[model samples]
Target: MHLILTGATGLVGSGVLHAMLTTPTVSKISILSRRPVPMAEGHAKAHVIIHKDYTNYPSELMQQLRDADGCVWAQGISQNKVGKELKRNREYIEITHTYPLLFARALAASTAPKPVTFIYVSGEGATTSPGRFTPIFGVTKGRTETDLLALSKEAGSNLRAISLRPGGVDPTHHKEIAGFYPQRTGIEGIGGLILPVLRTVYSAMVSPTRDLGRVLTELAMGDGAPLSGRGVEGEGRTVTNVGMRRLAGL
Candidate 1:
């Protein structure tokens, strides 16, 4: 299968990239990033595309993406990174909602013979409900999920969209890949220690980075039963961390 991946430099994206590169079934991988990906280097199947703009896809880029069978969208930013409230909200909406939606819409309009699956790496607390205390991150991500699912329904057999909502993604499970990024410190460092305990006592609260990557790859390759509505009814299109663990057989 040919696949397109975004945010290949991030922890989650790096894990997914590793899974894709190692899997024999995945024949080609198109990596979209602002800069070159180190892990993709020297890999024969990896194709790095330096795309500065996510909201706009040039015709040439669209043509290349049209040939792919699926996309694993891992692009996102932490709310704490963007300074000030106004700028943070704007950047969050653009990155979390606008970018992936534009890409999905473009692919849904394609005339490819086979169906294109889009796996969105969403978080656990994302919700569409409006509230006075709701965070902008949750609102944008929830809206994105709803819009992507609606688009999939409209596109029917041509496009399929699935959202994986994971909480506290632990990167320590795959040190070989996670080592590429800087070590977590402060609150993140503390969370890392507690994540393993959560995995054993309450698995839904956390997911190993490797497991998340493998499950995303499985969904992208259309090799899992969950893609066929075998999971819980009404929520098959959206899988929780618990479901992800089950699919990954962890």
Candidate 2:
């Protein structure tokens, strides 16, 4: 299967990319990033595309995407990374919501080799029904998932959209192969040190990067059947952390 991936430099995206590269079923991987992906360099199956704007997809780029069977969207940012609230909100919405939506729409409009599958790498806490204490990140991501599912419903068998919600993705655990696993620092590093304890306490809360990657790859390669008009927590569409672990045989 030929797949398109975004944010190949990030923690989650890198893991997904690694799985794609290693899997014999995946014939090609198109990586869209602002800069060159070091991990993709020298790999015959990896094609790195320097795309500056995610909101707009030029005809040339769309043509390339049209040939692909599916897309694994892992582009996103932490809320704490941005200093100002206004900028953070804007960046979060654009990166997490707008970019993937635009890409999906573009693919839906064009002809494809087959029904295109779009796998969104969402987080655990995302929800459409926001309480008084819900974070802005969750609210935006939830809305994005809702919109994507709605779009898929409209598109019928032409396009399929699915969201994978993983919590506390542990980057340390993966296949003993060449892959991009970033060095954790600060709070993330500390969390890595106690991952076993966290897993014991909250088994469903932590997802090993390898497991998450495998699940994403499987979905992209059409492991499960299409959605049966279910809601966001549908059988084939939305997968939680526990679902991911189960899919990966963890």
The per-candidate count of clashes, in order, stands at: 0, 0
User: Clashing pairs in model 2?
Assistant: none
Model 2, span 137-185: residue lDDT tens: 8888888888888887783546788998988878755654335556667
TM-score of 2: 0.89
As for candidate 1, its clashing pairs are none
Q: Where in model 2 is the C-alpha error above 4 Å? A: 155-157, 175-182, 185-194, 227-232
Per-model TM-score, in order, reads 0.90, 0.89
Candidate 1 Cα errors over 4 Å, as ranges: 111-113, 155-157, 185-190, 223-235
lDDT of each: 0.80, 0.80
